[model samples]
Target: MVQTVKLMKNRLAMYGLVWVLAMVAMACSSDDGDDNAGSREVKFEVTGNFTGQLNAVLITASGGGTSESINALPWSKTITYESNVPTTQISIAGAGGDPGETITVKVIVGGKEKSSTPGTATNSGTIAVAAPSYAF
Candidate 1:
């Protein structure tokens, strides 16, 4: 009986020692130096120019070229544009959202429906936002 009691006490001590060692290791191995302390990452930017009244414009994207889906885009608007003068001061909010994604821009001039020819987006590609974040 005493032997069994001693065995149990030894096991208890070993367990306590292991627990203490584990705690110490965890504390010492922690990120003692702020790994990401001062490092900064770059956002995305989406820039483009479209002529015509720009009846409507849609910005799209895809990630890893998988789904081929239009990741982030805008809706259609009912605005009339002039003939000679092209649209100016055009900027999208969430085009530069996620990186490594495919982007597509669609614009309709005169007629309705998605069948309208889509205008080129100046190859903004994966837009990188560098300022205040805008939620869509």
Candidate 2:
């Protein structure tokens, strides 16, 4: 009878261990369908010698997932996109420069300024900053 009890105790201990490991495995398993899985907030800031020349700026990120226009100078817009998004686009519009005249454009992402490149005012004095790679 003592031997049987001892065997039963050993089985109980083994069962307890198995139960703990199973619980741990369940805890470690990730639910890929989480709503916040790829979520992140990205900020785009438009600034420059806008002065009276700057009228409105268009910003788009994540393939139109987030887009808006700023009708004021030194404007900023914050948007959220998946961390996997590759790039974003910006466009600046104004009424001061000549058609097709070169204008300076500045962009800031995540509170840090991005490098400037040559942008030209359109026939309507609009300029585009195409597909800048998004920073994760």
Candidate 3:
């Protein structure tokens, strides 16, 4: 009888060990796909016409509770920005050419772009803001 009881206790201990290992595996195998839950990177592509002494373009990005201004870009450049929010408002403006001499501007974000059609950069003119979708 004592031998039978010892064998039962060994079996019970083995079962407990297996149950604990199963629980650990189950806990370690859950992944909800939110690896970037805190921050994400966004890219900006700025391109425009900088002619006749206009060598720089002013780029501004604001939104997601923050604001940034890049005041001197070489008319065509890419900017990488990091943010926790997935949408940002960007703008470009310039002035240095003759009257009606235009400076076409476009901003690319999240692989999407928005252009300022007929963006006129007259002696004292500007352009509006462009908002694009982003992802994290």
Model 3 error, position 113 (Å): 3.1
Runs in model 2 deviating more than 4 A are 1-40, 49-67, 94-104, 118-126
Candidates' C-alpha lDDT: 0.26, 0.45, 0.38
lDDT (10s digit) by residue, model 3, range 68-119: 3334443445555444223333334333335554544454443444423335
* Weakest lDDT window of 10 consecutive positions for candidate 1: 59-68
- Roughly what TM-score does model 2 have, to 2 decimal places? 0.41
Off by over 4 Å in 1: 1-74, 82-96, 112-136
Residue 107, candidate 1: how far off, in angstroms? 1.9
Indicate the worst ten consecutive residues by lDDT in candidate 2: 51-60
True-structure lDDT of candidate 1: 0.26
Instruction: Give the distance in Å from residue 65's predicted Cα in candidate 3 to where it truly belongs.
Output: 9.1
Model 1 Cα RMSD, Å?
A: 27.0
Writing each residue's lDDT as its tens digit, candidate 1 over 1-136 gives: 6776445444533443444333333332211233432222212222233221111111112101110112224333333323322221112222222334423333222331111222342344223111121111
User: lDDT score of model 3?
Assistant: 0.38
Task: Name the TM-score of candidate 3.
Answer: 0.37
For 3-95, candidate 2 gives per-residue lDDT tens digits of: 764454445334434443333333432323444333345455565444324432232344332223345545666766555544444444444
